[model samples]
Target chain A: MTRIAVDAMSGDHGAPVAVEAVMASLRAHPDLEIIVVGDADALNKEIARHRKADVGDRLTVQHAAEVVGMCESPARSLRQKKDSSMRVSINLVQQGSASACVSAGNTGALMATARFVLKTLAGIDRPAIVSPIPSRRGHTLMLDLGANAECTPEQLFQFAVMGAVLAEAVHSVDSPRVGLLNIGAEEMKGNVQIQQAGKLIGDSELNYIGFVEGDDIYIGDVDVVVCDGFVGNVALKTSEGLGKLIAQFLREEFSRNALTRTAALFAMPVLRAFRRRVDPRQYNGATFIGLQGTVIKSHGDADAVAFASAIDVARMEVEQQVPERIRTLLAHSLGE
Target chain B: MTRIAVDAMSGDHGAPVAVEAVMASLRAHPDLEIIVVGDADALNKEIARHRKADVGDRLTVQHAAEVVGMCESPARSLRQKKDSSMRVSINLVQQGSASACVSAGNTGALMATARFVLKTLAGIDRPAIVSPIPSRRGHTLMLDLGANAECTPEQLFQFAVMGAVLAEAVHSVDSPRVGLLNIGAEEMKGNVQIQQAGKLIGDSELNYIGFVEGDDIYIGDVDVVVCDGFVGNVALKTSEGLGKLIAQFLREEFSRNALTRTAALFAMPVLRAFRRRVDPRQYNGATFIGLQGTVIKSHGDADAVAFASAIDVARMEVEQQVPERIRTLLAHSLGE
Candidate 1:
C-alpha cells in the first residue's frame, strides 16, 4: 500500500480541512494510507465528523506539539520547531514510514526542513521546486520556482535535467523539449551565467531548445522551461496578479448595468468552463525535485480540494519513483 | 508649436503607419508639429495620400537615407549607420530642432543611439525605461524594463528616483510612493544587491515604501515600482503572455458551440469595455527617462491609434520636462 504523511496544522484552515481532505483522498484511492500529523486532539475531533466505518485503518493521526507560522523565519523554524507538524511530516518520509509527504506550510521552512532531513539525491547538489504552468497547448513544467534565489550555471543545468525527467514520468511526454528562460531568444542575450548555462544545456542529451523569453511560457510551444528561483518566483507571482486583475476587471464590467447582468447569466456556463480550464487550483502542487524522497508543497491557503490535489501529486511521484528516475538520469547524462 | 521627430521607417509597419499616426496626432493637438524622418520618396508618397489642405507646414518630411533593421546589432548600427532614420531622429532632439523624439523601432538600437546622441542627464548614471502598467485601481509606473540587465544597488536607487519623478510629472501625483520590487515583502528576502538597494531607497526622502512583491505591481497600492531590468523585463513580458493566453482561451470558449456563440453576442458590449480598459495599447509609450532630451519608445508593432498614443506621451513629457525633473530630484536626494 502507498502511504503519505501530511502536515495537518500548517495551512490557514487547520486540522479540520486536513481531515476533510484526507477522508476524501482515501475514498478516491483505496490502496492509499494517510497519517495526518498535528495536535492529536484537534485531528481526532475533526476525523470523528467523518464516517468512522468508512475510514477503518486507512486514516490515522500522529501527535505533534508545535506548528510553524506562515511568516516565521525558516532558520528559526528549522532550529526551534523540531517536533512541529511540518517537520514531523517530513520525518515520516525519512523513516520510511511514509513513501511521500505533502504540506501546506511556510515554503522556506518546508524546504529547509526537507533538505536537512532527507538530503539531496546522489548526483544532485540542490533540490529545486518544479511545477506545471497552464499554457495554450497543454502545460509547461518549470523548475526552481523559488528554491535557489541565485544559482550557478551548473545549478541551472541541473534544474533542466530534473524538470525533463519529472515531465517524462508525470506528464508522460516522450523526450520533452527543455528551454532556458532568458530576456530574449538570441544566443547573446541574458546575463553571463545564463549564457554559459545555455552552452551546457545545448551539449546535453536532453532535448534542449534555445533560449525562451517570458512570453514563450504561455505560448506553450516548449515543454519545460528552467530559470533561477528569483526570476521564476517573480514570473509566477506576476502571472497570478494579472489573473486577479483581469478577473476584477471582468466583474466590474459585467456588473455595470442590468443588461450586462443579464448577459452574465447567459454567459455563466461558458465562463465557468473557461475558469475551470484555467483554474490555478488544478495546478496546486509544487514538487521539490532532486530530494532523496518525495515531498509536495501545497499553497499555504489551499482549500480541501487543493490540498487533496497536492496529496495526489505526492502519490503519483511515489508510484513513478521520481527520485530514483532523476538519480539514474543524472548518472547517465553527467557520468556522475 | 512643440515639434517632435518621428523615425518614420522604424516600426514593423514602416512609413505608412508613421505618416498615418502623425496626421492623427497633429489633428488631435493643434499645437503639435511632427517631422517624419525617412526616405524622401516613400514618405512623400504616403504623405500625399492625405488631404493637402490638412498637410499645412505642421506635417513635414526630413529625408534619412538609411533605415536600421529590427534585428541589426545595436553596436554595429551605432558605429556604421550614422545616417539611419532612428539615429537622425535622436540627433534632431540633440540639435534643439525638436522638443521630443518618438520611435517604434528596435529597442536596443533606440536606447544605444539615444544615449549616444542625447547623453544622460547630469547626476544620473543610467537612463531607464519607465512605463505604466494597468493595475486594479489605475496603474503602476515601473522602471528599468530592460535597459540595464545587471544593476548595482545605486542604480536601483537611481531607478526609484527616476520612476517617482516621472510619476509626479506625467501622472501628476504628489510625492509618489516608490517601492523596491523583491521576491518577498520581508526585510531580508532578496539577493544581496536587492537587499542593499532596499536600504538605499528606504533612506531616501521621496516617500519611500518598503519592498513590494510582484503581485503588488497590479494590486494598485504602490505608485512607482523599481527593479533590475532583467526582473522587470521578465515581469512585463510575462504579463503580456498571460493577457494573450486569456484572450485566446476566451475566444475558444465563446466559439465552442451555438449556445456559447449566442452568449458571446449578449456579452459583446461588456467584453468590449473590459478589453478597452485593460488594453496594452493605451499604455504604449515607455519614456527613456534620465536622458538629457525626451525620447519615447513605442511598441515596434503598434498600429496608428497606439502610435498616436506614443506621440501624445512624448508631447506630455516635453511639456512637463521629465528629464529636468529627474535630474533635479536626483541632485537633491543623492547630493551628486
Candidate 2:
C-alpha cells in the first residue's frame, strides 16, 4: 500500500479544505494510506465531517502545531519552524514513514524542507521542478520550471537527463528527445549559458534535438524542454495567463450576439474538450525531482479536487519509484 | 520635416514592397521625406514601375553595394560588410543625413551596426531593446526585450530611466511607473541579480514600483517592466505565440457553424477593432535605446505596410529626440 504525507496546513484554503481533499482521495483509492500532517484537532474535525469512521486502517494523523506563513522567509522557516506542518510532512518522507510528500505551501519552503530533510541524490547538485504543460497535441514535460533560478551548464545537463528519464518512465516515451529552450531555432542564438548547455547536452547520451523556440513549447516539438528557473517560470506563467485571456476573449465573442450563442450550444462539446485539455487543475502538481524522496507541489489556490489530484500524483510517483530511476540514470552517467 | 532612412533590402520582401510602403506612407503624410537605402538600379526599377516622377524629390535613393544576410554573425558582418545597406542606413543617422534609421534585417546586425556607428550615449554602458506589448487594458512597454542577455544592477537602473523616458516621449505617460520583473511580487523572491537590481531601482528617482510577476505583463499592472534579455526574450516570444494561438482558436470557434457565421458578420466590426488593437504589426518596431541616434528594428517578416509603419515610428522618435531626453536624464546621474 502506498502511504503519502499531505501538508494539511498548506495552501490558500488552509487545513479544512486540505483535510477534505485528503479524505476524498482516500475514499477514491481504498488501498492507499494517507498521513495528514497538521493540527490534529482541526484535521480530525474536518475528517469527521466527511468520513463516518476510520473507514479502513488506511487513515492516519500526525500533529504539527505550527504553520508556515506563505510570505515568511524559507530559510528562516526551515531553521526555526521545525514543528510546522510543512516541515513535518517532509520529515515523514525523510524517515520513510511515507513514500512521498505533497504540499501547497510556499514553493521555496517546500524546496528547502525537502532538500534539508531528504537530501539530494549522490550525483545531483541542484534539484529541479518539473511541470507538465498542456499543448495542442498533448502535454509536454518542462523542467527547471521554478526550482533553480540560476544554473550552471552541468546543472542543466542533469536536469535534461532527469527530465528525460522521468518522461521515459511516466509517459513511456522511449528515447525521449530533449530540446534546449532558446530564442531561435539556430544553434548559436542564445546566451552564453545556453550555448554552453547546448554543447554539453549535444555531447551527452540523451536524445538532444538541437534547439527549440518558445512557440515550439505549445507545438509539442519535443518531449523535454530545459531552461533555468527564471525563464521557465516566465514561460509557464505567461502561457497560463494567455490561456485564460484567450478563453475569456472567446467567451466575450460568443456572447456578443444571439445567433452566436445558439451556435455556441452546438460547439460547446468541442470547446469543453479543448478547455479540459488546457485546464490548469488537470496539470496542477509540479514534481520536485533529485531529492531522495518524492515531493509534489500543488498550486496554492488549488481547490479540493485539484489538491486531491495532487495527492494522487504523489501516490503515483511513489509507486513508480521515479527517484530511483533518476538515481540509476545518474549513476550510469557517472560511471561513464 | 522628418527624413528617415529605410533599408530597402533589409526585410524578407526586399525593395519593391519597401518602396511601395514608403509611397503609401508618403501619401498619408505629404510632408515626409524618405531616403531609400539600397542599390540605385534596383530601386529605380521598382520606382519607375510606379510611374511617379515628381515623387523623386520626396524620395531619394541612396546607393549601397552590399546587403547583410539574415543568418550572418553580427560581429563578422560588421567587420566585413562595411558598404552594406544595414551599415549605410545607420551611417545616415550617425551623420545627421537622416533623422533616424529603420531596418528589418538581422536584429543583431542592426544593433551592432547602430552601436558601432552611432555609439552609446555618454552615461550608458549597454543599449536596450524596448517594445510595446499588448495588454488587456491597452498596451505597456517592456525593456531589454532582446538586446543584452546579461545586465548588471546599474545597467538595470539605467534601463528603467531610459524606458521611462521613452514611454513619456512616445506614449506620453507622465512619470511612467517602472517595475522589475520577478518570479514573485515579494522583494526577495528573484535571483541575486534581480534582487540587487530591485534595491537599486527602489532607490532610484524613476517612479520605481516594486516587483511584478509575469501575469502583470498582460494585465497592464505597470507602465514599464525591466528584465535581462534572456528572461525578456522568453516572455516576449511566449506572448507572441499565445496571441497567434488565441487568434486562431477564436477564428475556429466563430466559424464552426452557419449560425455563428451569421453572428460573425454582425460582430465583425467589434472583432476587427479588437484585432486592430492587438495586431502585432501595429507595434512592429523595437527601438534600440541608449544609442546616440535612434534606430528601430522592424520584424524580419515585416510586409511593406509594417515597414512603412516602422518608418513613421522612427520619424516620431527622431522628432521627439528620445536620445537627447535620455542624455539629460542620465547626465544628472552619470555626470555626462
- The candidate that wins on lDDT is 1
User: For residues A1-336, what per-residue lDDT tens digits would candidate 1 score against the true structure?
Assistant: 899999999978888877888898999999999999999998888888899677689888899999999999889999999999999999999999999999999888899999999999986888998899999999999988888888899999899989999999999999999999888512234478999999888888889998888999999899999999888988999999999999999999999999999999988999999999998888999999999899999998888888889999999999999999988888777865
Candidate 1's iRMSD: 2.4
DockQ of 1: 0.64
Clashing pairs in 1: none
Q: How well is candidate 2 docked (DockQ)?
A: 0.33
Q: What are the per-residue Cα lDDT tens digits for candidate 1 across B1-336?
A: 789999999979999888899999988888989999999999999989987566478987899999999888888899999998999999999999998999998988899899899999887788888899999878999988988888899999999998898889989888899998877612234488988988888887889888888899999899999998888888999899999999999999999999999999999999999999988889998999889899999999999989999999999999888888887888888755
Identify the runs in model 2 with alpha carbons over 4 angstroms from their true place: A27-30, A51-55, A185-191, A247-271, B48-56, B185-190, B247-274, B334-336
In the range B1-336, model 2's lDDT, one tens digit per residue, is 889898989768889878888888777777789898999999989988885654558889999999999989888879999999999999998899988888989988888889889999978898998988877766789988878777899888889889989889988988898999878612244467888888877876678888877888777778999998768888888777666665665577567778656656655665665566566788888999999998998898988777777877887888788999998887765544
Pairs of residues clashing in candidate 2: none
Error of 2 at B301 (Å): 0.9
Residue A331, model 1: Cα distance from true site in angstroms: 1.1
Ten consecutive residues with minimal summed lDDT in candidate 1 chain B?
B181-190
